[model samples]
Target: MKRFLTLLIAVVIALSAMSTFAENAKTLKIGTDAEPIGFDPHTTPAHASIRIMHQMYETLVELDDDLNVIPELAVSWEQPDDLTYIFKLREGVKFHSGRELKAADVKYSFERILNPDLGALGSTPSYAGNIDKVEVIDDYTVKITLSKITAPFLASMSSIYCSIVDSEAVEANGDLLRADGGTGPYTLGEWVPDNRVTVNRFEDYWLDGYNFENIEFYVISDSSARMSALRTGEVDIIIGDSAMLSIAEAAPNVDVHKIRTRDYITICLNLNMPEFSDVRVRQAISLALDRQEIIDLACDGQAEVSGFAPASMGHWAVDVNEHPLYKQDIEKAKELMKEAGFENGFSVTCTVGLNDHIRNSGTVIQQQLAQIGIDVTVQNKENAQYVDDWKNHDFEMMICQNGAGSDPNRAVAFFFGTGANANIAEYSNARVDELCELGAGTTDVDKRREYYTEAINIILDECPNVTFASPYNYYYASSSLEGYSPTLNRPLDVRNVTKE
Candidate 1:
């Protein structure tokens, strides 16, 4: 009887210890501008989608904090020739859907990305468009053949757009937009649209040290409100831009991190539009606005005026100061407007989202263009709707940010290259197209930079679209958080982060 009583007491004590440990486990809450644009990274070019998907999906390759290409699902890769590359998949990796990672899955992912019916409508398809075929050599080895020698092909695979999904689970689930079938550090727990997305850490995750048990992404559209949430301890972190940086800096118990990024803001113009189709009109519009002023007003002195290529691209870009067309000249702008027969000004719509910097930029640009007799109408849409409208080419002008790609070649190709998936501007130039092809094929660093410089110079003079400032990406977090660092290309990786 005494032995039984002692055993019961011991079991009770063990249970009490386990309960306390479980209660002590940390939960991370993050505030952002909006929830992911649906859940699939391939379908939407939204950063939110990529950020969340990074936790739920595993790319063959990934970028380290220094923007260096690192192995993820792929243990290593080799290129036997310019056109053919081979990859060896990691062994014993399991997907959230309980499927083992295989070469067939990689082959299917590449094939599905290129399939017209099942492919993404965004830049993912275009990134993999150069692929001739994906051949599965064995259960864990795959060979990818490209149509031509492409410089950014290997680096591009590191993107979230190239995230591998569990083929069997995705097929069974039927709806990929809501399904989570990936081999990432965490798996989707719940999603409430326009509100929050919650993900639980995957116990079977191959990599260790994913300290947090749960991560909740709350969508707070307003920058002030996001900052407020952080201040009140409702959320632990907020991903934002320069505008939110100041507020986070002023708040107590907060730490600010800024990543000097290659992301550039640009006003995309519909080249088919009668007004913008005229080069003089586009050039005049570019001349009217003060890019420096926009940077100061919208970005709170945390950014610089960006040129055709992002300033972060360094030596590869044409110096903005030396570019004649990039300089603002209000008189020249008015004269060009008069030359275009719009001396009395013409009204056009500038569509934007709820982002504070974008909205403020549009308003400031509207006021600036008025000086040159260009009547600008600001149209605010929800983030998803705004992106959809841009994709559908539904607006005369859309204020948008072009992301930094894995390489300079990909970055330049996304905006200036003809038939680029994100080329809402519908910009095309035979010379620029040839330059893009040349840049993609060139291996020498100097040769590649020269090719890009020529393309950037031509685009600057043509004014196909109005390039604005590149704002620094700032993330605010509670001081208690540790091991959190953001990369220029992919910000806010929480896999290794922990809280006190």
Candidate 2:
């Protein structure tokens, strides 16, 4: 009896010690790609990097699990006119520096976003493009006046780029933002570029306390390196898709989480240019390769052949019947080429980033196009440089991927509208633009769907872009981890996450 009692006492002591240790733990080890260029929310625009910045800043509004806009910094908002929106800010919120968050700060935040000198306008054009001016009503109230009625205006603000920053912090930072100034759930604790970024939990965050004690982000771009880190217990989580599933499925101590993504890989053809102006040439380009095979080789059988934008995304994804671009017929492609007077295939340069997936897809696409008598010269460039070149219209053909949001209008307006940054294809269709406008303006969901469905049909018929496959996003976590909920539109919400 004494022996059993002693064993029970030992077990209790061990459990007590573990509970105490967990409460006092102050560091979490996370692995990611290279560190962001800067800590400034406006300057760090890369999707991976910006997600980290979002942890340092809070937005006025956020999307819930269902992608519905809910209160975050702003308690509520009202539209007084077609072009004016009034917002009632949350009271008593404080920045990390102990400054009160006010309406002036909100106004300054929008103004900073609109400032041409900030250089963020290019990446977050959607937010700035709609706003004509901002008016401060009081300490906790502000009104945003737009140049025109944009139906998706509030929805656009839910994006990461629209995160509100402390105006005072920006002025003090003067281009190089300090680590610990925002009012997010975590404050930047330490930063070692290309190595690691550490953030400590902010007890005074506007929201309830987050479950994490600390977050440590490590930069490891290689798939093998990340897998090794997870396996060896050097990191607690991996966010990217490369080699995530294989490692998680094989490892006893890791859990793999998958999110259905609207992200799709596209082959963008520059339609405005003379070389690609012919419809036959575009048809030939589409015919040259097997999209399913590319999905198999590039994504390791993890992706789905995208059929006219993802249906799960929202109303703007035109019904498959409305668009015929998803269908692959090599014979039809040949016939179109003949009709366009290109009896002999022409040579064109295909540009792609040197990232893992991009390179893999590019190589497969080159071979596929070659099979259809189209000579494709693949040019590899650094990811950042390639994005710049594509935006500047410097490439004949470019391979790119787009992470679509829950709202289909967000995707349609940014990629299909006139002067859209993603419209590198320079595709201009008056009828398509009209449909897009009608869809965006209507508040009725069914009516909006009808308009977008028509717009998608026009886009498919025009064939401005060729889609290969839609990739799924995968994350790997240590088995000891809990409360790790992954969202399709947002990055890992580390706020509620805990490590055992």
The best candidate in terms of TM-score? 1
Tell me each candidate's TM-score. 0.92, 0.87
Q: What is the C-alpha RMSD of each candidate to the true structure, in Å?
A: 4.3, 4.5
Expressed as tens digits, the lDDT of each residue in 1-500 for candidate 2 is: 99999999999999999987776344567777544545667555455556677778777788877778898889999987888889999998888777889998878777877776765532433455668888898999989998866677787787666777777667776753555456788887787866877777777777774777778888787877887898888888886674567667889998888877787788889887665788667766766657778888887877777744675575456445323445667777777777887767778888987345676898898887776577889898855667568657788888887766666665666677776656778888888778777866667788877777677666666667877677887778778777777777555676656676
Sliding window of 10 residues with minimal summed lDDT for model 1: 118-127
Off by over 4 Å in 2: 1-25, 33-40, 43-45, 116-128, 173-181, 189-191, 211-213, 319-323
User: Which candidate number has the best lDDT?
Assistant: 1
Each prediction's Cα lDDT score?
A: 0.80, 0.73
